[model samples]
Target: MEYYFITGTSKGIGKALTEAILQNDNTYVYGISRNCAVKHARYHHLHFDLSDTTALRNNLHKVFVPLKEAERIVLVNNAGVLGKIDYIGSQATDNFEFVFDVNVIGPAILMNTFLSAYYSQQCPKIILNISSGAGKRPMDGWSAYCASKAALDMLSLTCQKEQELLGTGVKVYSLAPGVVDTAMQAHIREAESDQFSELERFKLLKENKELLDPEAVGKKILQLLKQPQQYSSVLMRVDEI
Candidate 1:
């Protein structure tokens, strides 16, 4: 049986992926998020606020389990935040803290925990971090978000090298799922043009119905998993995959 652990499963790509993976009778999903939005016999939801590391660490037993008959184990870090969508100086310091806590620190802890829990397991293991293009390029008002994601990309690359040295065969990647129509996008749309220079561009994307759908993106991710080696870059875009 295949096992998948996903964060941010209450909505967006996380929720879509969980539901898509559950269509198979031989797969089980452990979803971690603030709320439980999925209901299925094989889908288990663990309520978590990613910023609360102490609580998550204490309750991690519910997330990972021994893999006796598992075909593969996958961890998808999909939860993230945009923080305050304003220029660097205009945003509160706490906003940066919150963004890093959720985007970098939380995922780092989870990846460490996952490796520890399944270090000796022979099943194929994969770590997919939901990254953003903003991480690769500077954006006008996404300082916190971009920095956090850039950190996450480096983390994933480092882990991949570590896994290689250990001969663990764990596949680690940070992927940019370009422009998806999610709650985050809606929040971005609400930002004033003065604060976010891309305000008009984003508005046009929404108006033109150009944003990728969560479900379609989820399916594309599953397809990518089937042949991860084809797109060998540690940091990749969905189109390249």
Candidate 2:
């Protein structure tokens, strides 16, 4: 059976991906998020707060059995935050730390714990971190978000290299989903122009109806997961697929 462990499954691309995975035969999903938005026999909702590392570690027991038993296992670190939108000088220090806690530290902890728990498994194990193009290109007011994704990408790269040297046969990738129509986008569009120089660009994306749907991006992610052999790069862009 194909098993998916996804974070931020309450909404957006994570939720869409969870639902999409469940549509396949013999597929099961373990959704970790604050909200339990979906109810299905194959979908198990594990209430989790990405900001809390202790809680996440404690809850590892709840996911171990499925991870060990599944024929194919996939972990999608999809939870993230944009933090406060403003120049670095004007940004709140607390918000900066909070963003790293959720977007970088949380996923890193999860990855470490997951590897410790199921590194010996013979199944096709995949780790897909939902990264962003912001990680690659410097943004005007997205300092925290950009840094967090860049860290995640580096984490994936390092893990991938480690697995390669160890012959673990696991596929690790930090995938950029491009511009999607989600609450995060809404938050971006609402940012003040003075704080976010590209506020109008984001607003124009919404006004021009140019944002990609979360569901479509979710499907593309699934397609890539199924054929990971074809993907040679650990840093992937959905538009390139």
Candidate 3:
């Protein structure tokens, strides 16, 4: 049997991924979220604010410590925050800190804690960080979101290198799920019109109807996890799939 750990499973891509993975009889999914409404015999739901690194680390250890040896263990760091968008000089310092805490620091601390307890002799482990195109390309009012994702991408790369050095059978990846229809989109679209240039771009895309389904993205993630050699250390975009 294969076991998967995922965060932000209350909604959006995270919820979709958890449901899709649970469809397979051989898979067990452990989901972390602030709230989880889905119930399944194979699903283990954990509730916590991921922005708290120490608490997250402690919770992760408590959860994974009891799992039996398995052939594959997958960790998806999917929880993230897109703080209120504002012009670079106008944005509050607290906004940047909050974004970084959720998107970058939270995942990094989780990975470190998971690795410290994981004995890879039982299975090939993998870490998937759900990044964004905002990390690669700049948008005027998305400074905090972009910067956090960029740091996450680099952190994934650094983790890949570190895993190779340690000779651990663990692979890390940064994946972009494209523009999916989610609550996050609503937040982006609602940002101050003058400060957010991407608003028009997104509006245009929506008008032209260019939004991907979250379930489709989730399915692709499952496929990638099953074929780790094909995706290891790569920044995969849903559009490319």
Alpha-carbon RMSD of each model:
1.0, 1.2, 1.5
Q: Candidate 1 on 86-148: residue-level lDDT in tens?
A: 897888889989999999999999999999999888888999999999999998889999999
Global lDDT scores for all candidate models: 0.91, 0.89, 0.84
**Model 3 C-alpha lDDT per residue in residues 46-153, reported as the tens digit of each score:** 888877767876666666655676768888999888897888788787888888989998888878877876754568899999999999999888899999999999
56-100, model 2: which lDDT tens digit per residue? 777778865635467888889998999899999998788888899
- Candidate 3 versus truth, CA RMSD in Å, comes to 1.5
Total colliding residue pairs, candidate 1: 0
- What's the lDDT for candidate 1? 0.91
Off by more than 4 A, model 3: none
Q: Please give the lDDT score at residue 241 for candidate 1.
A: 60
lDDT score at residue 219, model 2, on the 0-100 scale: 93
- Indicate the TM-score of model 1: 0.97
TM per candidate: 0.97, 0.97, 0.94
Name the candidate that leads on TM-score. 1
Task: State the local distance difference test value for candidate 3.
Answer: 0.84
Preferred candidate (lDDT higher): 1 or 3: 1
Count of residue pairs whose backbone atoms collide, per candidate: 0, 0, 0
Clashes of 2: 0
